[model samples]
Target: MKRLAISLSALALCAAASAQVTITEPWVRGTVPQQKASGLFMRIDAEQHVRLLGGSSPVAGVVEVHEMAMQGEVMKMRALSHGLEIAKGHSLVLKPGGYHVMLMELKQQLKAGDRVSVTLTFEDVASKQRFTREVQAPVTALGGAQPAPAAHHRH
Candidate 1:
């Protein structure tokens, strides 16, 4: 009985430590069944200021952090080589028509209402700390009812 209690306590501690980064309201906008690309939106809350280095998902071969900006009246999207900065006690939001995670070379077709898992990596700028958080998000079709907007940040 004592051994069992100790094991359970250790498991709980590990779970908590693994989830240093909190992900909320994760959802993927709906796209054509065969669409080659799709975007993921979510909010990240960290206890301390950190940088989001990158992400990965089993559904896609490559996942990149991208930003959309208007340059010369032309909307351009570009990959951010430097990880995104997340200020302490603040939140970073990824949403449509703005900053988002681009999933490229999708390995599987994402259907509306389907749930997919994404892993996000974070690094603390001050301590050079690193951690990862996983979130399961449902895919909603484009033009579907939109979810409440998350906090936004620009590069």
Candidate 2:
């Protein structure tokens, strides 16, 4: 009985530690015919610090976490060599023209109202433990305006 109690306690602790990453408002930008790339935007909240490793999807052959920033008066977009970090108690907002998931080499044009399945990978900052979450993101119209950031909640 004592051993069973200990095991249950450990299991609960593991769940609390690793299952705190919440993904909300995930969406994929719709693509026009012949368009080869699109973006995935979402809000990520992590109770524990974690790194947003890149993700994969059946719709795209290549998926990368990219950032857009002004370089010498020109806007440049590039994949982050390392993943983006979400500090504990902070929310990471991914939107158009900022930090977002780049889905390239699209297999087919994504239409608005369609759904895409993407698997996002993440790593715990303290334990270096790797985990993945499956997200079903709805496709929005191409060139859709970026939405304002949602309020973040801290525990």
Candidate 3:
């Protein structure tokens, strides 16, 4: 009876740990066939404060977390090495013309209506723990012209 109780407790703890992070509305915007780069968007919610370590996808050879920022009249996209943070009770948004996951070195052409799978990694701040979840993204047509690379500043 004691052994059974312990086993049940462990199972419950495992279930609770896995449900801490949630992702929503994962999608990829479609681009021209020859286009080399594209953006991925999603919303991440967490029960506790956590940091997004990074992401991986089979569709692209390289996946990078990026942020768009303006510096002295020049807009630029920069790679985020430490990843984005998701505070408790808050959500993080990855959207067009904003913070995004840059999918580089495409393995196959992504077309409108196609679905892609990506895995996002999250780390718990207090526990120094990590977890990952897979998200499915559907490709859709771009709303307008592709975003241009951030302009260079000569200072």
Each model's lDDT: 0.76, 0.84, 0.74
List candidate 3 segments past 4 Å from native: 1-15, 143-155
Residues 1-155, model 1: lDDT tens digits: 99999999877755654455677777886776677788888888776777887789999888888899999989999988887887877888888778888888887778776887888777767767566777787777675534545422211
Highest TM-score against the true fold, candidate: 2
lDDT of 3 by residue, 4-99 (tens): 999998777556655777877777777776777778877777888888877788988778788998888998998899988878888787887688
Of the candidates shown, which would achieve the greatest lDDT relative to the real structure? 2
Q: Rank the candidates by lDDT, best first.
A: 2, 1, 3
Mark the regions of model 1 whose C-alpha exceeds 4 Å error after superposition: 1-20, 145-155
Q: Any idea what lDDT model 1 has?
A: 0.76
Q: Flag clash pairs in model 2.
A: none
